[model samples]
Each structure stands twice: as C-alpha cells, then as structure tokens.
Target: MSSISNRIEQISSSKPGAKDYINYLHSLSAAADLISYAKAIIQIPDGAIVARPVLAEFVSYTKGLADAREEVLIATLDVLKEKTIIFEEQEFLAREALAEVYEQKNEFTKAARVLQGMRLDSGQQHITDDQKVAVYVRIVRMLLEDEDDAGAETYLNKCALLIHKCNDPAQKVHFKLSQARIFDTRRKFLDATRKYYEMSLEEAVDADDRLQCLLAASKTAILSPAGPLRQRVLTALYKDERSVQLPTFKVLEQLYENRILDQEDVKQFAEMLEPHQLALMGDGVTVLHRAVLEHNLLAISRVFSCISFPRVAALLGMELTQAEDTIANMIIQGRLSGRIDQVSGFVYFDSEKSNLNVRQKALVRLDEVAERIAATSRDVRIY
Candidate 1:
C-alpha cells in the first residue's frame, strides 16, 4: 500500500498526460488500492492540466467499486469539469460516468442533469453520431424513469435527428424502439402501434426485433380505442405473414373476426407473452375480460337485429345492469351502432342498415360497369 501510494504521488507530481494518468490509475485498480488513488486524484490542484485525465480515470476506475464513495466520485467529476479545455473527451466521459453513478445510486434527476450538460457539438463531429444517440438515449431514459414524459419526448426528438446521421442500422432501430416506447408511455397507443407496425416491416431490422415490434403493434392495437381506425390497423396486422405464426396472432384474429374471447383462450395467450409485453399491455386478466365484452358487443352488432337484455347479459357473462352499462358505453363511443330500449328490455342493432347500404352501393357500381360494357360493344358493332 505504501509503494502504491508512492507511485501515485510520483505520477501526480510529474504533471502526467491522459495516457500516463490512465496507466497509473489502472495500476492502482489492479493493486486494489482505489481508495488511495481516489484520495490522490481529489487532492490534485483544480487547475492542473494533469488533473483532467486523472479525475476522469478516477471516475471510471471507482465506478464499479462496490464500496466507492459517491462524494469522492462527484468531487472528482467536478474538478474534471473545471479543467474542461484540457479534458475535452475526458470531460465527456467523466460526466457520463458521474451520471451513471448517480443513476445507480437512484439519483435520477442528477443523472439526467449531468448528461444534459454534455454538448455533442463540442466535439465538432469528433464524436460519432452513434455516441450522440447513446447520450441522448440515456438522458431520455433517465427523464422517463423520473416520470418526466414531456422532457423525455424532447430528448427523443433530439435523439431521432442524431439517429439519421448514424450508419448503424441497430442504432436506428434502437431509437425507433425508444420512440415507440415514449408513445406507449404517453398512452398514444395508435401512434405507438403505427411505429411498431412500421418497424416490423423494415427489412433492415433483425428478425427478433421485427417479431417483438409486431407483437407490440398487435397488443397496442388491441388497447387502442375501439374504432374503424383500430379495425383497419388490426386487419392489416392479421393479414401480415410474419405475424401468422406468433401466438398473439390468434388473439388478433379472434378479435378481428368479432369472436368472443374466452377466458381459457386469453389465459393461453397470456402464457405466451413476454414479461415486458404483459407489463406494457397491463393486467392480462382484465384485458381479456374487457376483450370478451367487446367481442360479444361486436358480434351482436353484426349478427342479431334485436336481442333481449337477459340474452345479451348471458352472452357477455354479465348482469343486466352491467351489460346495459357496457353496451351503452360502447354505443356512445361509436364502437357499437345500436340502441337499448328500457321499456322493452331489448337492444336493437342498427349496423344492419349500414351493411345493406354498402351492398346496394356495390350493386349500383356493377350496373354502371354493365352499361359501359354494352356501350363499348355497340361501338365495335357500328365500326
């Protein structure tokens, strides 16, 4: 220990460069003398040029030390920042290390602030776009972890711009996935679903990533507010060949076909979901429960012109009042085109008229085609 302290003192007194400082720090780390090294680094004069790299190296070396003190690490970083001109890249690295330590210590706001101070342009293109992307991603994650969705989104946009500058396909996909997650966090399910679905189609994305994206898209589509837009998105996903073999495909198909989703089916599907997927989609039990109700309502709209409230309740496995409330909510949301008659205790489906109108329009189009064909035949005969 005396020898190690002597070596550190000699290195610090000599005004070492970055390489020399790093080498000495590695020796201390290898000797398991990080405490002595940390004390020596902190004692270096604040304006000493050697202090920059020494403090940066101190931050890195002490980072993984289970017993390393936070104050020592932070004080080292503060000195590194003071000598920014000589530090340059070392300053960035030191700040990043400091931020990471803050995060590990659960000081998320401090972590975010440390990273936010790192200006990518300071390196003047010396820093790779990938590095810029990485920093922005960290900041976004920290902000998000701190429950600052709006702040995370601001960094998300910045990260996006840097992503385009990078040549790494993986980095681009990473940014996209992060962006989709932000949308998900914001409860913009449609936007999140669209992003995921689009990513699933990208040939550049790896198969595993594509599969995950498709699964996310399908789940978010299910969670999207029930509407024609939701139906269109689900239909597209249902027809996607890549999704056909995934376990979630069946759930999507069942929902798209307006088939009642049974508890057993949902349990089977839930078992297939990844832990993150299940968490992101919320409680699988409740999700399936709601899906069953939605499926029954949709099926009723498509099949039955009129049904007694008791029958509706039986089909949905809910009581009369519960069924009435669910159906009424669906109706008000424009998910179910129907009305309930309190006096008659009957629910009438009005979507059938719309279906009839669609068929009539198709018939009129066919008649127009027939008339055009006849006109063309007469013209040929006259010629």
Candidate 2:
C-alpha cells in the first residue's frame, strides 16, 4: 500500500497525462485500494491548474466507490473548498458533493447548512442567477423535508424572484411545485389550490404532473371555505375531461352538485388517496359530506314552502332528530333563511316571503315617488 501510495504521489506531482491518470484509477479500483486512491486524490497538487479537472474527476470517482469512507470524502471536500480562490467552479462542485454526502448520511441540517454557506460565500462573486436559484431551490426542499415551513417559505420567496432566471421549464416547474407545497404545509390552502389549478393548465406540465395537479387542487378545494369561488374551482375541475375518470373528481362533483354522498361512495374514494392525502383531508371529506347533506336540505327548503320534519328526514336520509338539529344549526348560522316550528315539527321555508318583502319594499318606494311627483306638479301650477 505504501509503495502504491508513493507511485500515486509521484504521478499526481508530475501531473501525468489523462490516460495515465485513468490507468491509475483503474488499477486502484481493480485492487479495491481505497487508501491509496484517497492518497492519490489528496496528492493532486492544488495549484495544478491544468490538472484540476482530473483532480475533480478523481474526487467524484472516489465518492462513487463503495469502499470509500465518509470521513475521507468529507475531508477531501474540505481540502478542495479551502482552495476555492484557485478553482472556484470545482470548489462549488465540491461543496455540492459534500452536502450530498451529508444528506446520504441523514444529516439533513448539516447538509442544508453546507449549502447555505456556499450560497453566502458565492454571493461575493459573479455567480450566475441560475446557480443561485438552483441553490435556493435545494435549500427550500431540504428545509421543507425537515418540516421547517417558515424557513422553507423564506427561501421559497427568494427562489421566486430568481425563477425568471431559470430557462429550463422543468426546473421552473419544480420550483413552483415546491412553492405550492410550502403553501400547503403552511395551511394556505386557497393559495396552494390556485397554484395547483394553474399548474394543471400549463401546457408545459406533462400528463403525470397535470394529473397530480388536478388531484391536489381537488383535495385543497374541498378544504377551502365554501363559497362561489370554491364552487367555480370545482366546476372547472369537473369540466376537465382528463380528470373525469378519477374517483376523487367524481366525489368532488357529487359534493358540488349537492348530491347525497353515501357511505359506499366515500369508502371507494378513500381507497384512491395516498397516506398523506388521507391525513391532510380526511376531515375535509367528512365536512364536505355534511355540506352536501345540508345543501340538499336547502334545495328541499327552496322547493317546499312547508315540509314536515319526517319528510325532510326522509329526503336527507337521516333520522328525524338529526335532520332537525342540522336545520336548526343552519338556521342559527343564517345559512338558511327559514323558521322551524318545534311544536308542529315543520320547517317553513321563508325564502318566498323574503323575495316578496323585497318586491313590497320596491312598490312602497315607487308609491312614494308618485306622491312626491304629484305634490311637485301641484305646487308648480302652469309653470
């Protein structure tokens, strides 16, 4: 091993030809000689400008070797980083490699710190915007993986500013996806849903990504506050012919249409969700199911001026008491403009009277205007 190490040292100092370096690496691999290979890597003179590429290649080759020790690789990277002024690009590459090594070892914080340090250090130089965006995207991903949404969000904004610098559509999509995920993790569902829906419409988004965007938008839309906006989003998703076959899409459509969702429908739809999806919107499905039932009840109220509690229960497929409580809550919440007669057990839909009141108010205003016009005419006389 010492003789092999001596020969590697001599070759590295002499800055041998590329073929010679290749032969040396091949012999090292053939013998599974990790120590000598590491020595050969470290012995490549730092100031050998002509041989820097070969040195980097050797370092990368050692990193890929199964027998290479973590400590040795990290130490080699540190050595390379120390010579950044001499080989700036290679130093950057070395930092990236070191961070990856830390990541492979499950030292995520350490990995992120390394990358963050690289970003700060490179800020002093003429780093390309694409490179900066790349680093920011990576840090954001790492921070998100570490469950630091706030930290991820900070970097995510920085990435957004530099996103235009990225010419690669896929990379831009990746950053946008990451930003959407940050919004999701932070519970900004509406914003996330909007972004996901937008991504679904992007022509650059591949079929798989488009499908995923639609699914995510559907899930987030369910959690969004009930309003015309949510309804509009659901309508768009339902009209998306590509998603017509998805089970979640079917569920969303049924809920939006105020159709009663039975247990079997929910069960089958639940099967299509990933574990994380189930966790994120498990309660959302329940709420949506309840909303559907209530919406159906509202429709019933609109159609029938007065309906017996039992009839309401029958229409909603619920027990009489559950129906009563649901309607009572709706009335309390002002969602249903109606009154429930507890003694008679009837729900009187006052929507018609509510409309009539508006008409009556309009007539009263018209009569007052006519009276005012007559009085003004009488006072004006022949003028």
* Candidate No. with top TM-score: 1
Which stretches of candidate 2 lie above 4 Å from their native place?
1-5, 12-23, 30-51, 67-72, 84-88, 98-114, 120-126, 142-148, 274-383
| TM-score, cand. 1 | 0.71
How would you encode candidate 2's per-residue C-alpha lDDT over 178-228 as one tens digit per residue?
877887676566778888988888889998878888888877776554433
The best candidate in terms of lDDT: 1
Scanning candidate 2 in windows of ten residues, the lowest lDDT window is: 276-285
| Residue 198 Cα positional deviation in candidate 2, in Å, after optimal superposition | 1.5
Question: In model 1, which runs have C-alpha deviations exceeding 4 angstroms?
Answer: 1-23, 30-75, 81-88, 98-130, 142-151, 157-168, 271-288, 352-383
Prediction-by-prediction clash tally: 0, 0
Collision pairs in model 2: none
Global CA lDDT computed for model 2: 0.69
> Which lDDT tens digits does candidate 1 get at residues 76-171?
456555445655676687678778778988889889998998867865327888888888888888887776778889998988777778877767
